[model samples]
Target: MAGTGKAHLRSSDNAVLRVEDLVIEYPGRDGSAVQAVSGISIDIVEGETLAVVGESGCGKSTLAKGIMRLINTSSGSVNLLGTNIAALKGEALRTVRPKMQMIFQDSISSLDPHLKVNALVEQPLKVWNRGNEEERKAKVRDLLTSVGLDPEVVGDRKPTEFSGGQCQRISIARALTLEPKLLICDEPVSSLDVSIQAQILNILQDMKERYGLSLMFISHDLSVVRAISNRVVVMYLGKICEVSPANELSERPLHHYTHALVSAVPIPDPTKVSGRAVLEGEPPSPTNPPSGCRFRTRCPAATDKCAAEEPQLTYAGNGHYVACHHPRA
Candidate 1:
């Protein structure tokens, strides 16, 4: 089930990351367990940007953190380049950590305020013992320039001195210090202004090509996801509702939930305005999600079967996969 989604995106045998039945649970009030991610599976092939899209509390961030081993997972395997790092600990985890780096949503807060920009970017290299002092300094200067920052000017200052966009660029440079094969961006541009978002996205695209990196991009912004992603995984209450090529998903979203999400993406042209899928209520509590299909509670097209039997993510032709019982045609 994990590798199946990859076929629907593209017939790629070179998967850089494979997540199988990944589940993440947190302690809830009164000793209960809140499932943040539930049996989510995905694959990101080499040089492909797989965007995980959903509203807040949809487990997008949790999934990303789980893959990076930032937080403990309840169950499942996270395979990176064929090694199941799910249970790896201590030295084993540390050795492979440099190969996968994450960019957080809050750019400024994620960076160390005390450290200068050059030191911050060079920290990964120093920790990993990549090069000598002179070599590391030259590498840092080159990375800063690649991300559109002047090393001599901005490298001396702390993250406080730069704008949100500049700080994010610094973060990108820091993440790329190891020349990581897989980069997981967890809402990296959500905090910036609309104009700043474009600049950051462009930098990310350029960096991906330059570094030959596969990206696991997590965001609630469907429009941005469409712009940057090759394939998209639509999450609802911790489960994937759809997986399709970015352009196909935007123009012909299969799942009802995905349709609602795509419809909400604001159209620039007034002449293209059409009726949107307005979801009726808020999402259900993760602690006690709806039985059968987790999204049945808020799904307008849900029927008795949707409430009685869980729908698995199955191929829906044209390299599109959908889990909804009543998918949109």
Candidate 2:
């Protein structure tokens, strides 16, 4: 069985993952393409949770899938654990894939309702040939117990028998079965109830520390990201708008689009805060994204400069980064 409780696997001495100018596009009808992620770059230092936050259709999921090689990159490089994922192919890709895993948004759809929990958790072990049948069964029980589920009771049951939160825990257990070094969580808690979301978050935090995991968490919930992520990356129309330490990004956002998103987060004290900013409009279509900055249409600080030249991510303060010509400072 894999070691539990802070195994200390992170290489703090170097960045475990690096993405440079990553781009993904899907061919469409009439010889056109829809750019899903456009020239995005990010670095994930070992053992850190980097949260990617954005509105719907902002390409957060696409970026995560791109990093996992679920979707082909049109251009750019994704280097994880010192391997260029874009260039990996066939057996090489399959060999490298075991180190990275993903947990999707809807646990309901992700799980196989037809399969029992024992089979579900043991699937990875079977595929990897980690152990004999008896050993695989033992590992499955251990995985269930680690996730705080009753191994005896849940192991024989099907996914359809569990609650939404329970189903998510099962999904997490399945993701961990591979003993992945990097886990990409795409809106893991978005589909749960408000109260259940907290429970799921606590479980995820526990798992992160226990497994010495590096995470790329994608979500639209800023509050949840603030609570769980060590660092933050904000995306707009398939491009990164800002990147910063979680607390710093929440308190001192730089990009106008990021600022608007920060302002929209509900303050604990109703009497102390007001003026929730409603951005001017929806995100532009990826197929026909605007020139220069994609956020110019909705950003209050947008100017002629923003509409003329695209901005590269640059340091703002205390490791914070922004990709806007007119950052809020």
- The candidate scoring highest on lDDT is 1
Pairs of colliding residues, candidate 2: none
Best by TM-score: 1
TM-score for each candidate, following the candidate numbering: 0.96, 0.94
lDDT, candidate 2, 1-329, per-residue tens: 00011111234357778887788998877789988888777778878899999999988999999999998999988988888989989999999888899999889789988999999989988988898999888888888888889999998999999988999999999999988989999999988998999988898889889988999999998899999999988888888878788999888888888778877777889688577777766887888887888888887877888788887777666877777787775
Q: What is the C-alpha RMSD of each candidate to the true structure, in Å?
A: 2.2, 6.0
Q: Looking at candidate 2, what is the lDDT of residue 125? A: 88
**Model 2 collision count:** 0
Clashing pairs in 1: none
- Over 4 Å off in model 1, which ranges? 1-12
Error of 1 at 188 (Å): 1.1
Q: Rate the local accuracy (lDDT) of all candidates.
A: 0.88, 0.84
Shift in Å, residue 306, candidate 2: 1.1
